[model samples]
Target: MKVRVIDNACRDFKNIDYTEVSANKICYRWQIFLEK
Candidate 1:
């Protein structure tokens, strides 16, 4: 899958805090990124 890495990092578009994000959510975001 193609992943979009802005600033050479994966992040949750809706949430600004990376520390609070779960691994599953990050994986989900990656899926969304691949779909885009």
Candidate 2:
């Protein structure tokens, strides 16, 4: 799974890379997921 830098992350989080994110599964915000 690969993800691009769609938008910069929160200022508190810098130097964070895409691989670090949980890309293996369907990851999304709780609110957004519910809407779908």
Candidate 3:
């Protein structure tokens, strides 16, 4: 799975540590975001 942060601020943050985050974690967060 591929995830891209579309927000400018989030893009900056993603450039930092997001490379280390697992795909499953990203998917889990996406699921939570969609539920909100």
Q: Ten consecutive residues with minimal summed lDDT in candidate 3?
A: 1-10
Q: After superposition, how far is residue 15 of candidate 2 from its true place, in Å?
A: 27
Better of 1 and 3 by TM-score: 3
Per-candidate TM-scores read 0.40, 0.22, 0.42
The candidate maximizing lDDT is 1
What candidate 1 gets wrong by more than 4 Å, as runs, is: 1-21
Model 1 lDDT tens row, 1-36: 254454224444435555545545666666677667
Tens-digit per-residue lDDT, 1-36, candidate 3: 233432433455566666635544665666567556
Name the regions of candidate 2 deviating beyond 4 angstroms. 1-28
lDDT of 2 at 15: 44
Query: Sorted by lDDT, highest first, which candidate order results?
Result: 1, 3, 2
The TM-score that candidate 3 achieves is 0.42
lDDT of 2 by residue, 1-36 (tens): 112222233211334433435432223442244455
